[model samples]
Target chain A: MSKDNKEELKNDTIKENQEEIKESETLTEEVLEDIVEDEVSELEEAQNTAKEFENKYLRVSAEMQNMQRRSNEERLTLVKYRSQDLAKKIIPSLDNLERALAVEGITEEVKKGLEMVQESLVSALKDEGIEEVPVTTFDHNFHMAVQTIPADDEHPADSIVQVFQKGYKLHERLLRPAMVVVAQA
Target chain B: MSKDNKEELKNDTIKENQEEIKESETLTEEVLEDIVEDEVSELEEAQNTAKEFENKYLRVSAEMQNMQRRSNEERLTLVKYRSQDLAKKIIPSLDNLERALAVEGITEEVKKGLEMVQESLVSALKDEGIEEVPVTTFDHNFHMAVQTIPADDEHPADSIVQVFQKGYKLHERLLRPAMVVVAQA
Candidate 1:
């Protein structure tokens, strides 16, 4: 072959070798970039899953705490008002005892005995956190105005004229509202 | 240059090109292998994270369910036993009324009124889930054996001879044990 032809063939081979090197380098770089991108996306997905679990755990924990608090409060309220139903039932018995005391035909001795019994019933009620609702003034919250009476000098307007039937309370809750007579102007 | 020298130069260049191409090819293969290894590890990590989150969520859900069931049961118990305290308190009042009824020399009117009061009291107690502990035989659970009597033909051994004081129960709970006289063999 001619020297020129030989030199041309060598240059072409060198150029081809350079292009192959460049292509291989680019391919390697692309593979590295793909690895980095895959790792980043995988990490992000794992992090998102962890974050979602954390949020769910937090929400469930908060709900559990709230339910616990509500249950505790309900239990406390129940304990505090444990005697409410029986205390309310006993009120009518107390009213009967008071009525028996009002009866005029009983002997003094019998009346005295009845008075002692009434006192004991009152004490039993008090021991169980039951008490008469105080109604010096007419308050709609605690006293039920059964009848309205004209205001007098002693009983001003909106004042309690008289309590017809006594009201009772257990703890802070009203067991029975006072059946009362309110004074009106 | 001589023909042999030129030939030698050309062969050296071709050999160098071949070595460079082989090196680049190996580097490219190594990079691809690294990318595949990185992706496999990343995928494993992601699976692990998801498994961990699933376990956490299941545990939290189970705990929350248990707590909810316990709280509901506690609330039900509280409601069921709400009248126990006042029922227990009213026992002594009932005893006093019984004593008053036993007294002699009272007028028939007074006796009738007292009977009515006792009935009302019993009704009230019943309304609040309080009932007398009935004892036909000696049961240690609800009856307190205060006195022992010799067993006769009429009264079998381990039988309740007489009730000195009535026992009462509020729902399933014993409010007061019956003070009784039991027959012995």
Candidate 2:
């Protein structure tokens, strides 16, 4: 009941409360540190996983682009050669006309018909992406002259003088090799 | 300097050493818990990202298969109709053979030549996948009636009385519809 006793009790209560507060603070600090560490690791893992997915996505996208490009090439090829069937169908008509020209035809009407047929054949060949191979000189890329012979001084060697069998081209590709007699050097 | 003082100093040293050990243990436990949590979260996130990528991979693979299937179907259709060009080229030869057959009063040599021509035409048609449309009573699907007339009272209606133009099928598809005369009721 004295002043000293009361002061002593107050000090005791304050010290006990301070210890409890310190323990609670330590526990809270431990839990907070654990949470912070877990979150940091989770974030690091998420970042790594995202990077890996980005790589995979890039690879897949590149593959898709390549496939699309290939498909486009195939489609272009189809369209470019779409009329080849019809052109092939008409070639025999040209052959028959050539035969008629070779035959002995005395009539004027037949001659006119042959000329008309030849013109029409040329038009058809032009229409169907087929044209005569341009091989005035002996270049090896487009023309294949099967035969070679020695040339005179006036005519230059490696020049195309005689064409035995005509060369045919279909859409920038060699359909048949030209059978020609070329000058020998 | 006294024995009591020496003993008290020894006790204080022991207490301080034990406190240091306890502090170290608590710190170590905190560090270990943090590291474990970090490692676990890192693994979990990596696994989740891997799952996402796998699903994407499967989807792309399915798309690739579909594209290939579609392209293959287109290629097969192209192959089935590959001979159309050649058949068209040979059609004129067939017409000429027909004209030769119609010619009358031929010598034996001429007859033999005509037979040879006919044989060649037949063989060519066979090789080119060209077949005449089979006709019996003639359903409308394969035949077009160019003319119609009343049948004999005994005959059934829609009977094929005559075939004017031969119908032809090229690889199971009608190239030209057959012209016919049908009997009407």
Candidate 3:
């Protein structure tokens, strides 16, 4: 009888230990599930942060490009009009020279002075990148026909006959077109 | 005697407890000191970050101001030169009319045409902020004295004798000075 009682007590002890082991396994499963969920949320948060950084980079780059383009356009326009004030100052000198030459039957000394004045004008204009437009032949791009003159036997048709106003070019672009009379067939 | 021994043992136990409490207190103090250091570092980091932001703000603002100044200057220059090409275009018409009137005595019809042409020239120039500098008096700022002419009784000493060149103004600014002969006593 005593041996049977001892055996029963040992069996009870084993049963209680098995129950404790089962409870620990369930707790471990719960902890593993929580860890996996936490990892997924952390990954999502890191991805969101990277996306925000990329957006900021793109915005800044676009702004920088706009600033550069605006400055470049302004620089180009400034160069285009660089000779305005100087041209204003020099036109009166040209008019004075013209009036002096227009006096009927100019003296030899006055003619010499006029030549010098023309030379000075040419040099001053050249220094400022001012060039005369070509007008020996008719060119549609750089001449405006105010009149059409008939072609003679010696003169070729479509040739420029007279230049009413001299045209100027600044930096290879036409500042003004030559007002011209062209010969026609 | 036994009571005295018990009291001594009690005192030993109390001493041990006191030492343990002191050790725990020291550990807590060390932890608090580390936390304070971390807080100080965080405060310094925040201050440095704020200063960096301020520096960037100031640099961007200064650049914006420089760009603004340059843009205004360019716009003003564009306005000044806007009429230069147009003026060059119509100058020949005026020159042609002027040449026609220069012939030996003018008829009434010729005089009327000349007056009309002159009026048109004046209006065109005035519309573009262009004006002629006065030639009745000589001024060093707007006149170049080319010679000293002998004055008659009608003119005063040190006065302008004649204007060789007609001066011009663009928006109250001197474009050219009149070339003149001055009289002296």
TM per model? 0.87, 0.62, 0.50
**Against the true structure, whose lDDT is highest?**
1
Off by over 4 Å in 3: A1-68, A78-185, B1-9, B81-122, B150-153
lDDT tens string, model 3, B1-185? 57556556655655555555556556645654665566555555555555555555556656666766877787786777655443443344344444545555554543453445455555756767767778776678888898987776977776888877666667766766778889877
TM-score of chain B of each: 0.87, 0.66, 0.74
Clashing pairs in 1: none
- TM-score, structure 2 vs. true: 0.62
Q: Is candidate 1 or 2 superior in TM-score?
A: 1
Q: Evaluate candidate 1 and give its CAPRI docking class based on DockQ.
A: medium
After superposition, the stretches of candidate 1 with alpha carbons farther than 4 Å from their true spots are A1-16, A29-42, B1-13, B29-49
lDDT of 1 by residue, B1-185 (tens): 98768867876887798798898788778867877787778777776877787777778889989998988898888888787766776788788788877887987776776666677878988987889999999999899999999999999999998999999998878999999999999
Sort all candidates by DockQ, best to worst.
Answer: 1, 2, 3
Put the candidates in TM-score order, highest first: 1, 2, 3
What are the per-residue Cα lDDT tens digits for candidate 2 across A1-185? 87556556555555555555566558756976777677766677776776677677668767877987897788677756654554544444455555555555324444444455456556646655677777678877667878888988865798888876566677877655566778888
